[model samples]
Target: MARLLRRFAETRPDEIALADEEGVTTWRELDERVDRLAGALLASGLSAGDAIAVHSANRREYFEVMAAAGHIGLRYVLVNWHWAAQELGYVLRDAGVRVLFTDPAFAAQAGEAVEGLDLPTRIAFGDGIPGFLPYEEFLATGPAGEPEPQVMGSPMFYTSGTTGRPKGVSRKRSIVGMPVDVLALAADGFATTFSLPGDARTLLAGPVYHSAQWMFSFMAFMSGSSVVMRRAFDPAETLRLIDEHAITNVHLVPTQFVRLLRLDPAARQDFSGESLAAIWHGAAPCSPQVKRQMIDWLGPVVNEYYGSTEAGVNTIIAAEQWLAKPGSVGRPQPATEIRILDSDGVPVGQGQQGEIWFRYANGDDVEYWGDPDKTASIHRTGGLFTTGDIGYFDEDGYLFLCDRAIDMIISGGVNIYPAEIEHVLITHPAVRDVAVFGIPDDEFGEQVKAAVELVEGIEAAGELPGELMAYCRKSLAGYKVPRSIDFLPELPRTPTGKLYKRLLRAPYWQEASREI
Candidate 1:
């Protein structure tokens, strides 16, 4: 892809490209800003393919920086603002980030992470911070001039690994890497069959750091749709923006959808047929009940896709197909191929539960940034990549997911990614040891549940659950917040101290063990 913004600027210069509460940017304006920002990045000593980490919320600058980086073939590492100092440092160092762009509120926190290292540059947005270059000042150093595009490279996306450390998944989409004919076919199918308009107004409700958010935003931009960006997901504000902007396309995780549905029915009543085009939910499994409710309340416009950062879009459950296969993730997209394999890597027959493996001939392929061994482990000799998710293909060819091959939880359709959550939870003063697992829920499908072993003499304060939840809420998204707390004497573990989450998840599976 030619820097995405460049194509939009050339094709739809006058069209509105981005919209937020602060302001709207036309394609022409966005192109101008990206040019200036790219110049600034170049002036800051960033060369082609050099990594630059961004630690900011969902502001226009976020996309601007991403596009600018793409234009210059500079690697953009979108830092999860929810990460602590240590987590941030690990990613920055691992990615070899030369510069870091962070919000003013997080300047001090980011500073703490880059303390001992010789960081390339640190530019703070919103307000000037001591010892940091202000965003305004950085932009003033370079004039608006289009930077020549370098040879296309892959985008490096770091997966929020729940089991081990986070791994980088790079996706390479060279210039015309995939034929536009295929893209148009897929895009048109999504638009017409799912009721998504080509020029729809979209509001990205979730954090853009994730691959799901980036994919949806990219699809919308490629289709000439206008995006309404949110700094963060607030149910009430999201609803208000939908109404105010007449947003047609809404992409969110199942948790966000649940929250929207939980809003006052009267406020939800304001959303009529024409006001919204389609609601796309993914990143995790959604409850069949929630899907039905969404269809009933909003119309038959709910769509779902099951895929991951490591593996590109594998299967999609369009609205029409969803009614047929209630909990299924539908069939693989046209450009993709999927197979369920047994432990020995042999393909399993239909209706047999096995690991889901995928292959894409034309789309982006999995490229682990620095770990060839990690990359090779997932890819088969034939180029198929195992999703590490246990699912089966029904006779009708729809894919249904079961538990992960690894102990991972999908809370509110956002990957709670247990390891990251556990890492944060273990830092609490009262927590002696902790094991986080996913518990089945009616609305969210699965909720993040933390079973903590409190310190020996510390009396369990009844308010610890609420306090711990509050602490996590401040650092993580609400969906990632642990919904239930269980005080445990000890967590079920192996001799090596690895938690067996299946043992932790057993009690919650009693009532509806095999039901949808």
Candidate 2:
């Protein structure tokens, strides 16, 4: 048996390991299924270090496959189900996926992605996907006992592809020599940092494919925490799940926080999220206003982490700490060393904004799966690697992010961060979401532009833009405030809360000769 599941199955066999919308899966059942699936993968001529792709929504079977792959030495690629056929196909090929597992919900796109590709194995979780093996039947084919030679495996997550085609974020410290026992032990320690003890029950309302969600849920699963998950995030449903399941912790993005805060006053006041001990959020710059509301409503359980798919969680701040240091992402993790460097790679002084770089204590670093040039672009001397985030540390050591280097707008020789404007604009009553970026400005080189998504039933006409601009003027300087505002019914944002700013900014910059 795998080290993780075996220990849990022996001690807490009847405890629920995973609960999706479909049903709950006990630890014993999960252990047995994982063993069989691991056996089947090994029996199908998949050796250690082989790759498989799982393209599905949040489900019990998703973790089952992940656990099975982790027990053996198979790298599991968590595909972004939102990708178009061409984009999906590119990832499948780039990862050299031998077997593809998908949900019936995305059957057509998955099928089109694999069409004429060399991938020979296809397994579907639910009905209605033709030419693919059923998940249950495939599991039944494997041996009932534990697979031999258990080794640790890790996930290879792809970048969100906001800039261009996504690249796989692979760790330089390969998993080939790591044992499952060591892996389980590490997961237990990692979960402890988030206050997730062995008996904690985690609620996963975000997509598991996201690195943060994946780390929170799966690591807790390995540490004996039961997970309650929803297919898609619903504000009311999230509160209900926490109350119903006695959920101890949950992973959320800033966007979800905004939505939850926007819920009816009755709905917000009716349910008490007393069981929630930790509400960790990241993946985007959360508005100070939204986060304050969540903390005020949910007590001080709302914690924040600063990280990316390429760089693991480097900094974290508790709600209390965040209250003291508003707009800060908090201090660096114990094992992380943070450095802010200028454009010439020189380390910047404290309180001076520059590109943020990280150095892991254990010498761990990120690499693109097949693109060495892309990987080298983010690396610097002394084993420091950057995620292109612009941030600075205060004298007290709290990290405050300005924006992504690519998203910085320069107007009349002054640098403006869109996140600062977006954070303030989103606090307005009529605004549901907002995206701020740089547009062509012949005088200032590049001017600030705002794209706002209004609240439900609010029209995008009349004095709303002026009202929003006036609201910003009260809190922002003249250059920092957006020069113009465009109303959209909705902004292009991923489920995980990352805005597709390029999509919003492309049209205005299409005819420009130069790039920032």
Q: Say which candidate scores most in TM-score.
A: 2
What residue pairs are clashing in model 2? none
Instruction: State the TM-score for model 2.
Output: 0.98
Tens digits of per-residue lDDT for model 2, 203-251: 9888899898899998888888998988899999888889999999899
Which residue window of length 10 is worst by lDDT in model 1? 175-184
- Runs in model 1 lying further than 4 Å from the true structure: 1-15, 150-154, 172-196, 362-364, 408-516
Provide the overall lDDT of each model, using Cα atoms, as 2-decimal numbers.
0.73, 0.90
TM-score of model 1 vs. true structure: 0.75
lDDT measured at residue 100 in model 2 versus the true structure, 0 to 100:
92
